[model samples]
Target: MRYGCFLSEPQGPDAIAGLRDQIAQAVADGFTSAWLSNIFGLDAITALTAAGVQAPPIELGTAVVPTYPRHPAVLAQQAMTANAALGGRFALGIGLSHKMVIENMFGYSFERPGRHMKEYLDILIPASRGEQVDYQGETLKANVRLTAPGAGFPVLVAALGPRMLKLAGTVADGTVLWMTGPKTVAEHVAPTITAAAAEAGRQAPRIVCALPISVTDDPAATVERANEIFKIYGQLPSYRAMLDREGAAGPGDVAIVGDEDTVLARLEELKRAGVTDFVGSVFANRERTRSLLIGAAKG
Candidate 1:
């Protein structure tokens, strides 16, 4: 499995410069890829593109950018443009987000998220490849072709459920997961997506799993910190289902925590479970965890 690092939001005055520094560090540390989340802070693709231009080339991707707010065609155009700017090192990861955020916060209909995503892909995939689109589905409509140059970057979906997993496998390049454990990925995630891809006659899909991790002497204290810091994920419907599938009481239960050897063993288990890429979110003991991840990548 390819080892990646989750680029946490940068602090201090110049956030963009800080992000660029982080990317440089990732390259220096010998990581295969680096990811950024897009919830409330910076625009993930734009920020990464800007940062990536300054740093040595390393694969950059959005863990997820919400699809409810942007039109698929526009997003495809933007992503392709960013990819071209970054010398084709960008991957676009999109998701439906949560029902509450879609309806209550963004004032968009969350009635048919699965259908929305399916239709969104109908427009996005072709448009990103510089093909003409004339789709009119139940949830979305697109009738334009993008003028942006096709960089041929992979598109991933933040898919957790069956419908989304099937869509990801059949249509997109892969699925990007968060708050999911190894058991769930082995039994439910990998099998479901791989079957769909096989049925569609597509190449093996990439399953990128991201999880909070810490290399600490005090595992119990780290678990407690994770439970408190990541409490919200346990309440989200999609993540909650994955946690339940893994029989995890909360996000902390699924977090990879322990000494270097233990954490490495857990990562190996994830690789055996068919994870193509692993992104570590160093929640605590940042230096120790990062050193272990870099060593894992190198070793």
Candidate 2:
């Protein structure tokens, strides 16, 4: 399994600052890849493209870029451009965002997300791969081909349920997950996606599992801190179902918090449970956790 580090949530100048040094540090510290989120501050593709050119050969990814406002063509173009910029090390991770955010925040219909995702990937996959895609679906239509890409990039769908996961396995390269635990990954996720890929005659798909990590001297306090910070995720319907599937009450319940050895053991369990790419959203004991994880990656 490859180890990736989620870029720390930026503050103040990070919005406009170049990420070359930060990315270099991750590579220097032994991370195989790095993930950036698509928040309001800086777009993931743009940020990664800017920094990726300067960083070493380590991989760069979009933890997720939302697929609501942007057209598949536009996103595909950006993703292909970023891939070229990264010398083919970019992984495009996209998702259907929550209904509340789409409707309330963006004023778009959050309608039939599973179907929407299927339609979105239909256009996105081919078009982003330097192939012409003149397809029309219920939710979207695209007539485009990438004319100037250095190379093709892998895709990772942010999938949760069976329909979404099946789409991810068959249509896309793999799935990039958040807050999904080993129990669900082992019994439900791994089996479901692997079976779908095998039936479709595709190679084993990448299951990139992202989780909050903290190498802490105080596990209880760290868990409580994570609870306060990530509780809102528990309320989101999509995330709630994943949590329920794993029998986790809140984000804190799934957080891998402890000292180095403890966190390492749990991470081993995840790998055994079929997580091919492990991205840690480090929280408490930042440098300590990062340092320990860097060793874990190296070892």
Candidate 3:
């Protein structure tokens, strides 16, 4: 399994131009990918392409781009364009963001999100493959063909539960998870998705796990800070269910926070538990966390 990291807008000059140096740092540190979460600030794809133009050879992925707001055709065109710009180094990860975010923040009804996702992917996957998708579905319609030269890269879905897992298995390249622990990946996420992929005669799907990482001498203090920063994740229903399945008290409970030895062991557990890619969200002692993860990966 390859190690990766999430690069947010750090508090400095690179914040506005995008963290190209950080991306280079991650690459130099032996990370396979540098992830960007699609949130309020700069658009992930735009930022990724801009950075990838200058940064060395390292994969770039969005933890998720919300599908509720953008149509599949628009997303396909955007992905194709960005992938072309990055010479197909971009992996498009999209999802139906949590109901609270979709309903309350975007003002879109989060009714039957699974079905909506199915409809969205019906057009998205084909469109990404350079096909002319003249498709109509219950929630979406796309009549566009990608004329872009680059073969579009992989599409990883941010899936948590069974339906989405099955969707990722049959259609998407893989599943990208957040706040999901080793236990859930071993017992729930991997099994369900793998079974679906098997039944469909597809290869076993990739499981890209995202979780907080802190290589700290003061583990307790680090966990406390993780709880403070990531508490909101536990309140989201899907994440709450995942936490409950992992028998976790909250987001911090599942986070991989410890000294280097403990963190390395936990990362091994994740790899053994079926995580194909580990995206570390460094919450404290950033360089140490990255160095330890890279060292563990080398080992």
Task: Determine the C-alpha RMSD for candidate 2 after optimal superposition of all C-alphas.
Answer: 1.3
Estimate every model's Cα lDDT from 0 to 1.
0.93, 0.88, 0.88
Question: TM-score for each prediction?
Answer: 0.98, 0.97, 0.96
Residue 285 displacement in candidate 2 (angstroms)? 0.9
Which digits, one per residue and each the tens of the lDDT, describe model 2 over residues 1-299?
A: 88998986556675434477778888898888999989676788998888778778789999899998999888988888888878889999998878888899999888788878888888888888789899989879987777867547899999899999888889888999998999999998899899889989999999999999999999999999998999999999988999999999999989999988899999999999999999999888888998888888998
Across 111-224, the per-residue lDDT of candidate 3 in tens digits comes to 999999999999999888899899888878888888875556899999999999999999888999999999999999999998888988988888999999999898888888
Best by TM-score: 1
Backbone atom clashes (below 3 Å) for every candidate: 0, 0, 0
Output the worst ten-in-a-row residue range by lDDT, candidate 3.
9-18
What's the alpha carbon RMSD for model 3?
1.4
Per-residue lDDT of 202-299 in model 1, one digit per residue for the tens? 99999999999999999999999999999999998989999999999999999999998899999999999999999999999998999999999997
